[model samples]
Target chain A: MARVVVDVMLKPEILDPQGQAVQRALPRLGFEGVSDVRQGKRFELEVDGPVDDAALARIHELAESFLANTVIENFTVKVEEEKAEAGE
Target chain B: MARVVVDVMLKPEILDPQGQAVQRALPRLGFEGVSDVRQGKRFELEVDGPVDDAALARIHELAESFLANTVIENFTVKVEEEKAEAGE
Candidate 1:
């Protein structure tokens, strides 16, 4: 099985209150030097076979249509590289 | 400035109702061939300077402590590649 990853993020101009809350909490948590933080969504889809161009195109369309709000968000789709099933 | 991306995902064994809802909606939306869908969160952190080993280690700690619930979620942290500021 091939795993496809879709990362959906807000447009650069958009404000992310969720991310802002985390960033604000960071300083209190003793983490420093973080200028900005933006929170987004990630989706993982398991496909039946190899990921070809057509599959990628279809996934991209899916991302744009259902996974992200075009008016305020942008998304990227990529196939995950295979790794050993056991042990990191 | 450097951009660090942290992707937080629920443990595979965890039930993902949100992702399941999307998966069920896909076929109704005219999409097919997706066996499974899992949803997660992505965070983009803009740092003031270069991302070095120490920074990465610190970010990893932050991801563990504040960005993710270790009991149920896993997170990966990476630096974003620089892209042209202009059009894609």
Candidate 2:
């Protein structure tokens, strides 16, 4: 099987209250120097076979339509190398 | 400034309802061949200075203590190379 990774993140212009809450708590926890934090989503997909160009295109469409809300977020899709397959 | 990325994922044995929902919706949307799907969180942190060893270590601590629930989730932290800096 082939693995694909998709990272969905909020646009820089969008306000992330969830991330802000974490940023606010950092100082109280004795961690400092982090200027900002943005929280997003990550997805790992295991495809039935080798990932080809068609698979990539389909995955991008999936990312755009289902994974990310383009109005406030952006997403990136990339195929992850299958180390197990490579080692075999 | 430097960017640090932390990815938090559930343990393999744990059930991921969100991912299962997506996987079920895929065929309905005319996308197929994906056997498994796992959903997780991604955090993008902007630190005030260059990312050195101390910075990486701090980021790791932040990830463990705040970003992920250790009982059910696992996380990985990595420093992203500053492309904007290299372009300068």
Candidate 3:
């Protein structure tokens, strides 16, 4: 099976309150010298079999229609290979 | 400035209702041929300056303590170079 990753984030022009909250809380948590924290969603999809171009296109379509709110968010889809364990 | 990405996801043993909901809805939406849809969070951090090892360590600490719920979720962090725009 091929693994597909979809990263969905709000448009740059859109405001992200959750991100702002994290930024604000960082100083209180003693994590200083950081800024601009933007939070988003990531979806890891395990395809039933090998991922082909057709499958990728369908995944993109799904991302556009279901995985992201196009009005405010944008998404990118990519195929990923599982990392081998250490010493494997 | 540099960009860092932190991907946080529930452990394999943890139940992901949001992911399951999407998987169930996909067939209804006519997008099939997919399984094991796991949903997670992605944090895009914009550092004020260059990212060094000290900065990276701090980011990792922040991710472990604030960004991820160690009780059930696991997270990974990586540095990302901004993709140049087309024709740039």
Candidate 4:
């Protein structure tokens, strides 16, 4: 099996209310050292087979179509070779 | 100014409730190829000065102190050299 990591975030020009809320809450949350907080999304996937470019393309399409709100958020997809440790 | 990106994610064994919700909604959202979705967090920051390791360490502490629930999630912070375009 392989692993894929997808990240979703708002375009630079987009205002993120969720991120804004988190940013505003930081200081009140007893974290005075913080200035801003921007919220985004991460997705982890374990595929049944090898992670190839085609699989990545499909994932990108899936993200664009449903996983992300293109009106504000854009996505980045990455695939990794999953290594399994023996001796459980 | 410089930019910093932070990513927060659940440990491999941790259950991601928000990700699960999005995963369930995928098929209904007209995405048939999606199998599962796990949600995490991304943050982008523009600093007043150069990007440095000390600044990153402070950001890490901030994230741990308030931005993320360490009980379930871990954070990775990256500093990128943001370039400026002249003649704008």
Candidate 5:
């Protein structure tokens, strides 16, 4: 099976209150040296089969239909096109 | 300033309990058609200045020293080498 990675991030113009809250909590948790933190999200999904245009299209559809909100966020997709070196 | 994006993900050998918990919470939170969710992380950092070997090295160091725990995770870095068309 091929693998796909999707990253979903809030647009720059949008304020990320959740990220800010987490950043605020960090200092009290003993994490210092961080000026700011903007939390975004990532997902690695395995396609049931080979990588092809159809599979890419389907994955894009799934992302839009269920995985993300495009209105406030932007997403990018990457497919594993070749065997990974780490598997060696 | 050049932009850098970092993706931090749990190693495949590691079980993701937090991701499982979030996935379980999704359906009750009104998200349907979602079978699984494995939460990971994304970071987009704007370098205070230009994109150079020194700056790239510094970012990598920060990621290692502060942003992530390397033992259970792996990360990839991408630099914005060209102007984005979206900014047009």
Candidate 6:
């Protein structure tokens, strides 16, 4: 099986409150030197067979239409050679 | 500035409801061929100056302590060569 990874991120122009909260929490926890932070989503998909171009295209369609919010967010798709092993 | 990405994912043994929801929703939308899905979190951090080993270590500490919950999740950290550009 092939492993497909989709990374969904907020548009740069958009403000990310979750990221901001993490940034704020960092300093309070004595972790400094961070300039900014942005939070996003990651999806790992396991497909039943080799990941050919057609499969990639379908995955892209899924990412665009179902996985990500295109209006204020952006996403990227990558296909891995092997399935992600259980327990890392 | 340097860009650091922390990818946080649920442990394989742990069940992912969000991912299951997406998998179930896919076929309904006419998108098929997906076998399974797992959802996770991504964090983009902008740090001031170069990302040397020291910075990476600090980022790791932050990731371990705050960015992810170690009990049920796993995380990986990568230092990007350049900052991600705005808007694609």
TM-score to native of every candidate shown: 0.92, 0.91, 0.92, 0.74, 0.70, 0.92
lDDT of 6 at A82: 56
Question: Which candidate order results from sorting by TM-score in descending order?
Answer: 3, 6, 1, 2, 4, 5
lDDT-wise, the better of 2 and 4 is: 2
Candidate 2 segments whose C-alpha is farther than 4 A from its true place? A83-88, B83-88
Better of 1 and 5 by lDDT: 1
Per residue, candidate 6 scores C-alpha lDDT tens digits across A1-88 of 8788999999989999999999999999988889899999999998888789888888888898888889999998887775443222
In model 6, what are the clashing residue pairs, if there are any? Answer: none
- lDDT, candidate 6, residue B38? 97
lDDT tens digits, residues B2-88, model 5? 667766777777788876775666556654444555668877665555767876766676666556678987777678656342200
Name the lDDT value of residue A42 in candidate 5.
84
DockQ of each: 0.56, 0.47, 0.53, 0.29, 0.23, 0.58
Interface RMSD of 2: 7.0
* TM-score of candidate 3 on Cα atoms, chains taken together: 0.92
Query: Candidate 3 on B1-88: residue-level lDDT in tens?
Result: 7888899988889999999999999999998888889999999998878798999989988998899988888888888888421100
Fnat of every candidate, listed in order: 0.66, 0.64, 0.65, 0.34, 0.22, 0.66
Model 2: per-residue Cα lDDT at residue B61: 79
lDDT of 1 by residue, A24-77 (tens): 999899999999999999999998787899988888888888898888888888
Candidate 1, residues B1-88: lDDT per residue as tens digits?
A: 8999888888888999999999999999988989899999999999877799999889999998888887888788878867322111
lDDT of 2 by residue, B1-88 (tens): 8888888988888999999999999999999899999999988888888889988888887788888888888888877875221000
Instruction: Report the Cα lDDT for candidate 6.
Output: 0.87
Question: How large is the i-RMS for each model, in angstroms?
Answer: 3.8, 7.0, 4.9, 7.6, 6.0, 3.2
Off by over 4 Å in 4: A24-37, A82-88, B23-36, B82-88
Q: Candidates sorted by DockQ, descending order?
A: 6, 1, 3, 2, 4, 5
